[model samples]
Target: MLNIRLASSMVSGVAGELLAAEAQTHHLRSTCSTSVSTLSSLESELESLLSKTHAIDGVTNQISSLALDTRILSLNATIEAAHAGEAGAGFAVVANAVRDLSRETAKATSTIFDHLQAVLSAVDRVQKVHEQLREQMLELDRESGVLAVRVKEQGEIVSTAVRFVDEAIDAATTPCAQAQNAPPASDTYALAPADDDYALAPADDDYGLAPVGDDYGLAPVDDDYGLAPVDEDDPYALASDEADEPPDSESMDDPYALEAV
Candidate 1:
């Protein structure tokens, strides 16, 4: 029983470790799954971001094209003003202002285009990184699934071992349990019932004679050596008597009478 108990303890210990490992593996798998989902969401959001960046880049290009068109229009107006000589003088001032405005617009558009390009480049880099992370998440999810399977298998094995150990312990202790619970066998060494006389000897007061008292054959006392007998009518026959007259003090004076009383 002791050996079986020890073995069961060891099996229970192993089972506990396996259960803990199983729980840890399950938690890790859940983490992997959540990470994978997050990565997928990030990928979709990154695509949307890239799309918006591309749209902004296209808008910047359109702005730059519009600025170029304005520059061309301003150049044409300046040429027309030059052709008009003195009439062209005030118009030339207007044409110069339009040309300067167009130049500034073009410079601003170029700056916007450079910023948009940088933004698009950043979006592309982010998309690439997101793809890599998504792949890693998928791999980790797969590995976690495998680990969960292995952990489940190990847990089952440990559980089966624990069950077997328990059964074995039960089997090992069965005889002892039965022996403890079984009625004791008729004792071969115990003395058998003796003769009727032997059994009746103790009831007959074998140790000594029966106690002697009034209930036995003892005779009642009738005399106190030489003293007079107490009268049944004596007032002081008992102190509890209601009669007030006391017995003769001379009769009580006898020591033998006092002894009898």
Candidate 2:
């Protein structure tokens, strides 16, 4: 019984530990879910940023097209200025300056486009990383959920085992407990007759033999067997008519007579 109780206690303790572990696993699952959600949101924001960055590529291309048109217009002005020599020297110089400005604008636009592409690439990589991280978090959450469930099952099993052990201990001890609390044989069941059920024999009535006195109704030994009465004062006196009296033949033949040696 002691061993059973110890086993029950151990099982209960294990159940409690398992319950704690289950709770922790649930908490971890929740944490993982939350992290996954955060990562998903971050990934979405990165996607949006990437989309906006790609939109900027269109604007940069428009700028580059405008710069190319400006350079072509500047070349046409320079050719017309050359056709009107000396009279359009200043216009040619201005045209050259305009072309140089357009070329510088185009270079700046290309540099901006390059930087934008790099930014987009970085954002894309970060988004992909977040996607992978989110997937991992989801997997972790699932695993934690599975762990929690198994722990709960194990805890229930342990609890059941503990209950069975407790019941076994109860079953084992019930008879002993009842015996300890039970009434004794003398109280529960009678082995001897009760006072009310039994009566003592009356002094006046003999069960089968004659009543006491008068030598229990026997004839006097002196008269019947020629023996004297026993001395009432001496407990060990032998019966005789006289100390030296010889027995008669009938007394010698009597079986009740005692002859002196």
How far is 85's C-alpha from truth in model 1 (Å)? 2.0
Q: What are the TM-scores, per candidate, against the unseen true structure?
A: 0.68, 0.68
Residues 54-165, model 1: lDDT tens digits:
8887887888888788888888888999999989988888888888888888899889888878887888898888888888878887887898888889889988988998
Q: List candidate 1 segments past 4 Å from native.
A: 187-261
lDDT of 2 by residue, 115-169 (tens): 9989988997897788788888988988998898899999889988888888899
Q: Which ten residues in a row have the lowest lDDT in candidate 1?
A: 235-244
TM-score of model 1 (CA atoms) = 0.68
Candidate 1: residue 163 lDDT (0-100): 94
Pairs that clash in candidate 1 = none
**RMSD to native, candidate 2:** 8.9
